[model samples]
Target chain A: MDFFIQLFTDPVAFWNSHTLLIAQIGINSIIASSMFIVLYSGQLSLAAPGFMAIGAYTSVLMDLHWHTPLALNLAAGVVLAGVVGVLVGLPVLRLRGVFLAIATIGFIEALRLGVILNLPITGEGLGLKNPTADPLGGINMVLVSLAVVLFIMWRLTKGRLGAAWAAIRQDELAALSQGIDVARYKMIAFVLSAILAGFAGGLEAHLNFFVDPGDQQYGVTRAVQILTFAVLGGSGHFLGPVVGALVVTTLPWVFQQAHDYINIVTGVFLIAVIVFRPQGIVGRGGLAIVRPAWWPRRARVSAPSPG
Target chain B: MDQQLLNAIFIGSIYALFAVGYTLVFGVLDILNLAHSAVFMFGAAITYSMVVNHGLPFWVACIVGIAACAVMGLVIEHVCLRPLRRRRAPPIAALISTVGLALIIVAAIEQGQTGSLFAWLWVDGPNSVAFPAGTIPNPTWHVGDLTLEASKVAIIPISIALMLVLGYVIRYTQVGRGLRAVAENPRAARLMGLDVDRMISLTLVISSALGGLAGILFGVALSDISPYIGRDNVEVRGLAVIVLGGMGSIPGAVIGGYLLGLIEVLALVVLGSNARGGVAFAALFLMLVLRPQGLFGAQLRERI
Candidate 1:
């Protein structure tokens, strides 16, 4: 009880205080929402982190190397990321399903390796350091960036492109027959989502004041966590990825606060969701109570040592 | 010139093994098991633990780990994949699930701390683990001017034997015939009273076990084991082998693996270490653009 009280009184406490938890939720919600824009189109991209890396790295490079202003750098990062998306999407969006997945995986891997190869550009994986100023300190910049990107995404996804994305995702053959250019719609989805991801990455880099090749979070593990969040939260709706991201990002933190076995808990959660709740936490419709037969109810709950 | 060629063959043989497993799974299921590399990692780490940490014999450790992967493969099929199949889930769902599963495995291994990557898994590290010189003691085998280590000599012949056995198993066995049936048409196979689910599960199990073996051998040559090594390079090489040889063709995987291996080695010799991975991938990208169906793969019939 004393620990909890002291935590609340601590300056770091506000970041986790019950009242401020809403802010954290809002920030995560934005990232998750952006994820949904791609997942909705049947593209479970593992390149979210890579897009972020691009945004972050480009921002830092432009700011330091070219002496660009913060706002201009941010815009450049988003635009560059979108352009990359379009370029990659043109040839790749033609491939369906696993082929596309593999191609994207290849893209992320190559980009990461490229960064390592060109050490002058990416700081040789040691990372770029302290690339931004505190207009209102570090935390506010993250919140403001999140809000702006989320607003843009929310508006765009609720408009014309979102419906087209839904149509293509539901049945590509039918969508094509109905005169929807499947490839074009997919490109839009990819580019738009990438823009948001890039923006997010830029903010993250500045906040942390460092950027590494590994910083892109395009790693297989992070991709899976993001995917799990989108699926669990309900990709079909606006708030699905938000719900998913919030649960995934924060659950580990909460668990870590109490014990070391966070991964085991998360793994069990993942297995359970896949087997029993494929639609995820915010998912609706039928099969809500029909527990899957394959998933064992008795999960192994063990406390893991520190990572 | 001789050293480069031998090194390529030595490295390529392991790739041949890796490619074979991937091609087998893709050939039969038409699904890319993205987690295949993770399975390979698990195999290496588990085997390493048994041998290095627990003091089991190397061969014993390898066998037990391979068996463990076979079981895990079966479980993956049952838990992650079977539902998708039952509902005829979209290819995207399977792809997403596999990617997610790959992350889960990587994280689980990271949590264990045993499979953490060494800088030299593919990149430069403090000291590249090298097998001691003259450990074999036999005079190096000479193919013209090419000098081959005893271990290197073993790879091609052993690979041939393994491939031959696999070929026989697929061609001569009843289970193989059922697998062929399902691969050709799942619905048709089911209509013919074949246990489609079981065949799919069996395919994953066998492929993952083979992948497990490949990982162990790879660790020996590299003189290191790291979870990060295989995912991209192995997948690209496997896919390239399949594309160049033909998808769903086991013989193609073998031929393509060696061809690719040789090409990469020659390129590395001419180009440099830094450009090796890039050159390999660039060649694959070009191959994909030029001949998507591969040299031997029959063009897939378009679904209406």
Candidate 2:
């Protein structure tokens, strides 16, 4: 209760005191926005976490080995993740919907358990310490990168590419009939989404002093968390996931009293959202609900459609 | 070689038990019931509670656990699935809804332990108890240069019996026919005077019961109960099984279950336990890429 009250009452104080939380929220929003791209194109690819893992590990390892500036390491991380995304996407994209989801999960688990756990370069899963971690320096970078990603997403969605994506998402056969390359457009979205997730991952690793390769860090759990942001925020619009990231990242602070039951609460809320507002918290028409028949009519301004 | 084969068949039967239920839900409903595993965990939890906390007989506890799972299945269908189905929501909506249901159930079971440590300690902790093997006799079978724990060998025939029973019911019973009809075309089934809702509900009950039975078998065979056991092992392997067997194919699920079991165990022996899980999924990844239709699945006409 006080958490919410404090935020509402002392906005500046809250922002100053919760800089880390704010930065984390910004990073999650970037990941969520990236998820929004894949979902926008009707793909159920849950490979964000895997890409995040790739980005985090690549950047952190480069930093540890060469003492490269953070920008170079982060860039390499994003590029490598995108490359892997393409490589993985080519074969697995043949399966649709839930099958695709499961296959991607397989990809992530194999990567985490088979490669990461076994590889000595990843510190053999004991995790690596980040000596030059800037706990405070990252906030500006996160906020600025988030702005750039959002701008790019907004412009992309408004362009011909976004139209192609929308058509593919709506109906692939129809999209193909219209001469839109369904496979190519999907690959583009998948790759773009990977790039965004990778960027988020690199930024996240930069925020902390340690890079942990635990399953929780880059496994099915993280995948679900990414999915939750899109689902709760409403995947129909770009803004939906951004808002979702904000609310979900802040929920524990908001419902401080029920922190222990946060998972159940989030689960219930997600289920309820799907049931009641299948479009999500933000819909095409800006929020939707089925009002009971007993609710007052719109002042009976019009009863003339039949006539 | 014989010992490895025996080990494979033993674990294969148990994997078949869990995979069959998972496949059944997917076959009929055409959506993954991610909470199927949570129901599996609940069965073990209930059995553990009854045996250790209440001191009930093992058989009695198993029966009660199965019954409770059946009820829990109905609740999931009602709470998580029915609303979305009625609204004619997208398939992914149903998928995500099931995930949400899984999350809630797992949280409730784990006592809100999100992203916790490795599962060994959690399962054998003070809260849950090991299955009492005394309730089912422990014996051994021996041959030249080979010995098999009766508990393990029993899984093959026991699972075979259960599969036979399931096959018979699906082939011969009225309710089974209704389920198949609905699976083929829900609207058509409804037009044909079939109660589609009732059939779906009944299917959930049966699927959940199978999951519960599988959990109990795991408890008896492994002699331990842990909430993590269901989602961790079942989620990945059950998925690989369904895909390998051919989606919506019962025989495919069973065969794929055993095949995957063989592959996992053999992979463990060859690659070491740490890399064994990756081997199964690597197999799945390859199978999906090369043969998306699976061994027995109908040829897929579309690609994502």
Candidate 3:
């Protein structure tokens, strides 16, 4: 009605805080979706932040060092990050679970350290500045981009590659035994994940109008947060990360209004989720609310009936 | 050559202590406990508060901090880990949740303490504590004039004693054997009537205690703590040790720690401190590339 008209035509009439909040939502959605690709493939690549760092750096370099067009710079940023992801994944895919987790962490650390040492380009530990505002306009562009990316991701996951990746996640050896090329699937997932993360990073750099090593920590921390969202929403489902992201991102704003007990609240909620309902809010074995047709057969049958 | 080697050993011992805690949890439960570094930092923070604010003795503060760390580890096991185990949570969930726990810890600590207020709470300002810098001021046992410092002399004995005690506990203690059994096969151990959950909790407690010990030592060596001691390169170093030493081997932990420490120190000595971070990361990358299973790890058995 009036809200939709205002949202598109007179969006500026809305409160600045609300606009920023929506922007935040869009940004986090990109991050969550980027992370979901790898989770789908059965890997927890903790180095999402490292790739984000690369993207951010590349964008900054393009803007400052070369003064390139925003579109070109961002494309290059995403591509560079994907290349790095491919390189990192090649060696680490052989590792499983905790080993892969550690390796990815190491990858992040290495890149962060490299940025620190390479002061001439990366601005060293002091961090880089001189960020410009988003060229396509802030909230609108982000919203449009998010819709496109989500649609693309949704389509991708429904295709053959998605099934193959899921099989690899379920059982890598079994997938290989069934003639699925595990390494190629892993690499595709890695590169695709990195590209999305990098794209988000590039957009964020323009949104924030600056980049720094500190921002790398944000990426790393958010990557973990995004993974939490996926798990909390049931990573087995396509819409899991998105739903989880909406809850987690919005929860903080709600808590912010109160200001007190933020950490205690977040900490307790996280603990409860991990302990009591590790399958997550909408997850199987949780509250067997109307079972969606998409719910896996094994999960649906295993649900404990609530008398 | 002598000074560099001694520096390597000094740094190596510290990393070795940190790695011991990380490796113990990995070895016993096959869980990385991503919150471990935060726990380590908490130990140092607790010690700093006790020593500087409460005027407690150093050793007493260290013990109290370690005890608290053990309790925290147990709490994490009870509150976070056990439920996940029962629910058969995916490994990714476990890892991410722990990391979230870490973020919660860091944010809470940051907000509560306002780190800047306590940044200089325990600094020794001008009278810098000194460790033996050179190989020997005057080599009494002059092995070709290669001198050694008094601190260097102490490092070997302390590390060796700690390792031996750890080894003895793991080899002879019933609890230790139960931990090994749980790590090898949780279902089998469960059927054998071992309390799997309790054993896992004990593993976390032991690892946290070791981390606390390392924290106290690191504070002593660095001469300052800012509630951010374990947040930096240490966790990465610890993870590297676990990976490079074989994912779950204690001896591998020690060897990996020392080797990484040596590589880092040598990189610093030759390349400059500015390059140390890069060197540490480069070493980790090489390790990942060369042996994904780690130096002491056997090929991982793929789960059916």
Clash count for each candidate, listed in order shown: 2, 0, 4
What are the clashing pairs of model 3? Answer: A131-A209, B135-B147, B135-B148, B136-B147
User: What digit string (tens of lDDT, one per residue) describes model 3 on residues A1-307?
Assistant: 4444555777667445367667877877787787788888998776677777788789878898789988898899999998888888878887776666667766776677655446777788777775576643677878888999889887888999999999998898899999999989998998998898888888777777657676235434555666777777667666777777777776766566436446556766666555555666665654744322223656355678799
Cα lDDT, model 3, residue A128: 78
Evaluate every candidate with DockQ and list the scores: 0.25, 0.48, 0.30
Query: What is candidate 3's CA lDDT for residue A123?
Result: 82
Off by over 4 Å in 2: A291-307, B112-129, B132-136, B141-147, B299-304
Candidate 2, A158-274: lDDT as tens digits? 899899988888898999999998889899999999999998998999998998877667887778778878877788777888888898788778767665567677778778777
Q: Please write out the lDDT profile of model 3 over residues B53-161, one tens digit for every residue.
A: 6677766877888998899888778666766766676665567567667766555545443343233323322122321233123223445656654434555677768
lDDT score at residue A104, model 3, on the 0-100 scale:
77
Model 1 C-alpha lDDT per residue in residues A21-94, reported as the tens digit of each score: 44445545655666788878877665676677688788888988888887788789989999988877766666
Better of 1 and 2 by TM-score: 2
Question: Quality of candidate 3's docking, in CAPRI categories?
Answer: acceptable
Docking class of 1: acceptable
Candidate 1 residues lying further than 4 Å off, grouped into runs, are: A1-32, A133-136, A215-225, A257-264, A286-290, A295-307, B87-89, B95-147, B227-249, B284-291, B299-304
Deviating ranges (above 4 Å) for candidate 3 = A1-15, A215-222, A257-261, A285-307, B1-4, B111-156, B298-304
Ranking by DockQ: 2, 3, 1
- Relative to the true interface, what fraction of contacts does candidate 1 keep? 0.06
> Residue B227 CA error for candidate 1 (Å)?
4.4
> Per-residue alpha-carbon lDDT of model 1 for B1-304, expressed as tens digits?
8778778888888888888888888888887777788787767666766765566776787788899788878867876788766555445455556655765665555545334342112222122233234323445577777776665567678778888888888887999888888888889999999999889999999888888777777766666666555564575566666666666778878888888898788777887666566565555545554555556656433210
Which wins on TM-score, candidate 1 or candidate 3?
A: 3
